[model samples]
Target chain A: MTDTLLEIDNLSVDYETGRGDLQALRDITFNVNKGEIVGIVGESGCGKSTLISSILRLTAPNTRFREGEIRFKGQDLLQVSERHMRDLRGADISIVFQDPMQTHNPVLTIGQQMLDIQHRSKQSKADKRAHATKMLGAVGIPDPEARLKQYPHEFSGGMRQRIAIAMALMSEPDLLIADEPTTALDATLEVQIIERLQELQREFHCAILFISHHLGVIAELCDRVVVMYAGAVVESGDVREIFHDPKHPYTRRLIECDPGHLKERARVLPTIPGEVPDLANLPGGCIFRDRCDQALARCATEVPPLDQLKEGHHAACWLNHEEATS
Target chain B: MSLLNVVDLNTSYGAVNVLAGVSFSVEPGETYALVGESGSGKTTVIRAIAGLAPAQEGSVTFEGQEIRGAPEKVMRPLRKDMAMMFQDPVGSLSPRLTIRSLITEPYRIQGMKDRDLDTEAKRLLEMVNLPTHFADRYPYQLSGGQARRVGVARALALEPKLILADEPTAGLDVSVQGELLNLLNDLRERLGLAMVIITHNLSVVRHVADRMGILYLGRLVEEGTTETIFNEPRHPYTRCLLSANPEPDPDARLDRIALKGEPPSLLMRPSGCEFRERCPFSKEICTQTPEWEVNGGHGLRCLAPLS
Candidate 1:
């Protein structure tokens, strides 16, 4: 049986904005299984970042968790004390952000920052340095020993991202949250980073909670995919199923609209009409109904529950309902 | 004759050489894409063409007029016919300026006092499919896609014959990117405008660009029709780039060619072929710079080209 590494159940978050209560995440539910790479794909304002922040317990000051439980290793992270959360952050979970340039401390040497991450470890200083060097080398950095002494500025964008990945995986955390880690890099560099992450994941045997807006990267890297739209989980399934046979209209449109997926060059690429509804003043019915082409009349008044369409595949849409389809 | 011709263009910033003998041309209604990594000088090529970055050497002829080193007086009038859409959607626009002023500012800058700015602003917004009410909104108030629409509207304000767009779909979501691409494509067709698009996105290049040039160390490694280049790439760098693009299809074959290391710094470019350091097919001859060779409308600058 597959082991679940992390689980989020009925998670809802709201930001107390001047305009109104901005519902950032609404009943978000998903889990990262042991050693499995699961990607959370969504556009901006889809609450992907908010979800990441919530998991790290680094939400904004005006944030309120409406209702949810973030369970990790049989412990509810939401119920954990700040001291306990700090201990679990690096030791059990690690994150690699989008911009590596901003991620690193300019004044600190790479070696120093990497060593600082191991503060929880009782390992000797020499052992820590050795581990850091080895981790750097594992991520394809040349001369890791000498490189550790250098500053982040000395490295190129690709190299800095590699260093960032190395630092994140140094602790060998059970779950690695990569928030658009390759988005800032070029296509060639993106490919290199993806391959490196795949290799590192294999070596460390860590589950990856990969988050990105790029459908191509998610398709290439993740085994399963969770498609988010306007602060809600629209669909979740195997990567093949999600891309090949998407059930939700949003997921289908998102996949079809991806330029990378187009087989032939067309002058007018298909586009999903309408903007994402305002989070502060959401529509009465389904969040995505306004934009969904095949939206039904029932979608105007009632919210669709996430239903099991197939084994391990779930989609939240009125069209997926038995009676609605009939 | 081509609408815009850039021959042997060379641009340097202080001590560092960015664009080294780059050359290309765009037809009156064609779209030409410049593809490269971050430091490959794709943006710099367009910047030099637009006279924003003065090129130290080479010629840029627009509509039979030499404009490489043209003074502002000479270039100002030409700006009406050739507009630029910057990379950043919101950041490119002034935060304080209303969307109406932002898009219509071009007309004011050109000193065209005859036109009513309000009507023109509404017309521009309508063209970009943005609502008329959005004219009063600030750059910060608009979404990424909306901000991009404003950028397009601003570029189209003067009824330019040619447009230079940099990374048009860089920051948008998949669906939004498609919408922007569709809008751009529709505008290009409707106005019969030529375009020079600079971006690292291969998919965007494939969808929008009629012809494309692959830049390595500020030099064009390959130049040809998008169809020909995508189907039969001669340069090893081109092949590597295409292979590196992750296909959205999960079942697609993953025969990725991982380059050895990052691109060499511009301050100290590798001798001979600049791409040789990372190239998998580097030979003894690669130590000497390969001459740019063209065959059957396809051009390449590599001694050890893929057969």
Candidate 2:
């Protein structure tokens, strides 16, 4: 059996704004193995979040699909009906957002929120309660019996994050997408939460599509990585290769951007020195041409295809780093 | 002499106690960072020291003056000697004002209506490594980083003896974070100003702060020289926080300290150590308020190295 759990092929999304139709993602492709942790790294507004929402068909109004497909287990997800997508959400695929406040319902108790997620697919109310309690236990939450009865406000931010994680796992979904899970959390709590998440992913053998801007998180958790910029995949490789041997100019800039990484280099890393291009009026050439350090005359007119640098390592930068060698 | 001294301080918001018996000090040229998570009372300590949140108990001495409950007249003069930078740049800056006007607001407060506020504002903007032309731009037009520089320029308008920065670089990018940290350190060295930086980022302590204090809820848990705390921190909570930070080096894997339970609420504050509820090394006696052990001028609040 193919170990690949999810594959996103040339997926793109557009939204109508005051500026008109904005293509947020372009020709993005990646895959995740059944039990592997795959990270999507990008700057803000790089279409990382929009990419996840498209898979769930959860994109808000005025957001239209431009092209491409999302396949989970060789079945086309983009073609799935809205009712089918709803059924698959809590059962086969799940997602956790950056904001705990948004993920949780203030009016409902944590048990109610979690139990309710799976009740439509499940039978027996008391049986659902037992599963919720077991899930709370699995997430390393304290006082599972009592906590299930209390409202979301009664819990601390860290506790609420645990509840959100437990809620996502309640259905035993094969794939879990967590978008910047630790962004707003305290450093200590963020650590605890990531640890619990990795442990659960292992226990369930669940594939995780981990999205974060922090390379530190990717190094610690992800098995592989896909680097995004200006609504395109700039680089994709194993976590080690992407971090240590990045090929794209954007990839190098992102790695060298970290204070810890810059400590070893002699000169300070001058960040890419410009904002991400407006997707609505993208350059005819490579999207990163405006900010690329080694842009040549060809780079200003020719869009670089995703060229292979090594086995399973790909970069879209026009610079032939491989040609410089053997 | 220590530039600022806060002893047995307590401050509240309406009916809720924000800071309880918080005490710390900053030497004339040192940067003392108060490190903690949100709602851990880091900002409250800054507020209490600045007199924005008037302390209901204890004393705050700036340059040996016991000026806890000074009247508006007395405090207004002190404002020239102390300045503050808030966390959110967009909200902190007056939305309608241009960057030039925002930077010179402090000068206007000090009765400089006749002086060349525009020229002085340009100088302040240039000092923070911002372009001279940036002064003409509105706060809304500036990016997150540019707005922060404007904020810093405004904070420096008074030429204060001390600067209190609350999460100065919280929302900024990684590259921008380094520039701001270096800017704060450079400003401190060049101007010989005392600084108290309040932030949740522990990495800042190593680069900018001379001394560091870890706050849990409203109580200060661990404190010491930056080298001491980062190398041999005795508190479990401190260890957990440091480990949780994404390691700069990709090769090093952090064995995160597992804090299984939730941190206790401030309303029902713990009887002893505020961290005892979630600490990995909590003992029976940790249920009692521990004394501050001052050794070699390093302080820690714990019944640690115990019997």
Candidate 3:
């Protein structure tokens, strides 16, 4: 899409092990439009984490990207220098990690963390407290003035998450990536935080890359979704279309698997026969061939291209798309 | 007869009262939900009933016998009648012990005689839909769903009349969560067990709980049937609780009620109506404790109850 905020082409990541080179992600391609929430969803160990890490260059020395282009806001992130990337990390692009308990410094006060974010954006330490309070209040932290003095341990799980979100937004990045930010919270608070985050996203006019294992969450926050499996993009489409009439077998299984999503499917839940295939040593041809109920002989020997079905929607399956053309 | 009856339950931590003037009853095959946010003291009431923590006031009657603060030995027999599942599966199940040994720990502690611990453990595992060979593996060897199954097996080992599950499906993926919830519902029906599920999930209560109770700070603000709570929440706190939860489906848009400010500490709780400070519809009587009102069997703790 010409209006795309991000266009990842042939992205691949590798993890070096004693046994051999572990292929964590293989030739993944996807895009997120401006102001659209695009979800990257997969079960744990399906390389969801690796994909996020690669985007931020947070991968350890043991991991390496073989080939890909990460074009964000018309700039190549992979080719950017450390100094340039550091400036972009919080100011131009930001991330909210899964666990605030670990992401937040336990001993430091919420004020200190907020100040740190402001400091990164070239604000004075003395003037950061007020800015921090304003940011915290914006995130819906009640009595942000008094709360700034309290340490992370003193805050409840939900409150800590709010503070963490405040930190992510302090710099007001254009692209905000949240990976399972509500996983550790109670359901009551989980819903509140997500709602608040959605409001904030709209108010800030920023694109969100929401990552989670639950398709239910993607159904909630994402405008578009990119289904990942065994280090490949299985399907990509508008959230409503993909959810209502999923074509790919993996996408169909995922929609049928979620109890909450079954409101639409409205039948007996169909679980995928086996667990996510091991990414390190993948078989030739389509990675989903072994598990697909409709797998043909050609699917086992030749890799299927991510073919277009309609405007801004694609699926990598050997299905007839001419009939589905809109 | 009601399997469990708690009346005017007033529990405390040191001098701080956490549960005040609470009353509820669980029928032989009913599921009761204790729903609330953090610091709402839902867990405290369960802990008090389990005797992990003591209730400073009120009575807990099991099988029509009241035991306010009995000695551990006097309460020993009742322990067999109740079992609790913790939120953290790893912490609840011993990392050092195999799944087989974990399930039998309750029986071992009570010093039961002529019990085939291994065989019973394996059967319990199967009951929870765990693989038979998983009995040999420790907690670390299992996946999140497997560990949850082990926890369920351990909780079911003694065939307790009542089960207190604290956030049973927290930290699990969606598919696994559905399986675990369905499994629990199936078990409850087959065993005719009474379950008091403590969670903040409104959707969870909708599917599993027959009745609902809403707690705020340290008080039971509302109590009624699931349909009553969802359809006509009388208390402002309960309404806010429901409205706060965003529907996972994007097609549905919910105008959430923003509950600003932290919950007042129990050490020095607000004068009256713990939720008054953040309540959207607080009235003059909100400053004073509202009298309980019953309409169509639904009781509410709000000055201006929803009609």
Please give, for residues A1-326, the per-residue lDDT of candidate 1 as tens digits: 34988999999999999998999999999888899999999989999999999999999999999999999877899999999999989778999999988999999999999999888889999999999999999999989999999998999899999999999998889999999998888899999899999999999999999999999999999999999999999999999999999999998888888888876898888888888899999998889999887888999999999988888899999888884345
Cα lDDT for residue A31, candidate 3 = 81
Question: Tens digits of per-residue lDDT for model 3 on A47-155?
Answer: 8888888888788899987999899877878999988888788887789988878888878887877776676545567568888888889888878899889898888
* First chain TM-score for all predictions: 0.97, 0.94, 0.93
List residue ranges in candidate 1 displaced over 4 A: A323-326
In model 2, the runs with Cα more than 4 Å from the true position are A15-23, A60-62, A260-272, A289-297, A321-326, B12-18, B94-101, B116-143, B248-250, B267-278, B282-289
Better of 2 and 3 by lDDT: 2
- Model 2 lDDT tens row, A137-187: 898877788889999988778777888888887778999999888877767
Q: Best candidate per lDDT, number?
A: 1
TM-score of each: 0.97, 0.89, 0.89
Residue A314, model 2, lDDT = 88
- What's model 2's lDDT at A253? 78
Report clash pairs, candidate 2: none
lDDT for residue B167 in candidate 2, whole number 0-100: 87
> What is the lDDT, from 0 to 100, of the residue A24 in candidate 2?
95
Report, for every candidate in turn, its global Cα lDDT versus the true structure: 0.92, 0.81, 0.80
Predicted structure with the largest DockQ when compared to the true one: 1
